[model samples]
Target: MSQETVNYLVNLLIGVILAGVLSQYWRLEASGQSLRLWIIAAWTLAAADLFFVARSMLPPDTLPRLIPTITVTCGHALLLLAAQQTAQRPQQRRVICLIVASHLLLLLLLRAVPAMQGWRAPTNSVVWGSLSLAAALVLWRAADHVRPLMRFPAMVMAFQAFFHATRSLLATQAAVDANPVRSAAVQMLGDVEVSLFMVALFVGVLVAYLRQSNDDLRRALANVQQLSSMLPLCAWCNKVRDDDGYWRRIEEYLSEHKVSVTHSMCESCATKHFDEFKP
Candidate 1:
């Protein structure tokens, strides 16, 4: 209907796509079963968001009362999973599972009582703040345990949480007064918030993963390669020595490195050494 509404719809669809894509990516590259489960959890949250948008036949307050409860619940669940179980440490994973159960219990309580809607309003802020903090803590939580590349996804989550939290707070404020222009502005803002955060989080993690992969491939390649100039060898003795060690012949080391060689001898060496006939 309105430009704000259209933008909101567009952003919602785009965010869903991004979340699904990112989830799939995580599912594919994730090292552990728990990590893949978390990615699926994230996809679940994104699906809830889509459901919220689809069921918005009623007013915003009423629609949010259902879908957002599921969305926020799934979101926190997914984030906790990602934070603690990406690398699948059993102890941390247990803690994460506890946190998830606790958060969902809170959501269940809120759903049973409409008065808890106020509490739901602060959810985005709390979850985002928590996400940002959790990601930061991951820096120290298992810094010695996790790879730097593994940290990228958490950082992306942190940014996503902050954006969603701010958007939710602003949208709540906009909902209170029933101001037309402010409501429109809030809708526009939500679009921007959701779209950009999805892009940043998904694309950021993907790029980081690809870069890490490239670096690993390069390192693996470097291990077997030598960039140095060839060393002098004793032609008569058929010995080849590198900076590291002496080899019986050039063919020995070359075989390991996928190099092929053809045997050749000068006419003098061929006749003198092999035939033992000198002019």
Candidate 2:
């Protein structure tokens, strides 16, 4: 297969796998709903990439190119939403809507004015880079609220922003007669870099989630242990005394604590209550 084909396959696989993993966690209590937005972003970008690979097969038109731009912009917007949610910040819905609308307007302008086609690449690069940088900033500012391991995803976002910006600058410098071999090599390298970055992002997010989940579990276990250790029970009634100094049945206390209690008489209790019926 051609290098471009290989790149397409690699990116497609990465996107699918990441989306699938996020979907699996979607239903889990510990995986928070924010991840679902991130999954949507991943899928959107993946679909855009797929379109990019198939661009040659599609009719050469403004719409074909515009579709990818729109999808990519939407994906980045979703990423911003995910980051905001992850940091427990108020989602600025108006700002997000404005961003999307502005991008769409710019895209429409580009489509209408053939003279401005040359500016499309740089403009898109700026938009993508800015969104990534914003996400990184959000992650950095919210560090205290998230696990320390979340720094990995933040760093990845920062690097991606830098790469996109640099690529845009480099594209502007390339001569019309640039060496085909060098251009091809650079393009291949960029694809590989992007694929690797996406993989890193997936792993980083997964690790952050797992670490947070583990910490939560540890805290919950500790609370349970502490509760078990200090529980006060009445010797005669077998009722438990809560912190409020109220005496409650053991089952009632457990139930109030969000623990499920099933009623069943123990073997000893059964034998004591009905000695002749003991099996």
- Per-residue alpha-carbon lDDT of candidate 1 for residues 44-76, written as tens digits (9 for 90 to 100): 656655665566656655535465555655565
Listing every candidate in turn, what is its Cα RMSD in Å to the true structure after a full C-alpha superposition? 9.5, 7.2
Task: Give each model's whole-structure lDDT.
Answer: 0.59, 0.77
> What is the Cα-based TM-score of model 2?
0.75
Stretches of candidate 1 off by over 4 Å are: 1-8, 19-42, 58-65, 85-91, 111-116, 139-156, 160-191, 226-279
Best by TM-score: 2
Instruction: Estimate the TM-score of every prediction.
Output: 0.58, 0.75
Model 1: how far is 260 from its true place, Å? Answer: 23
Q: Number of the top candidate by lDDT?
A: 2
Query: Residue 20 in candidate 2 has what lDDT?
Result: 77
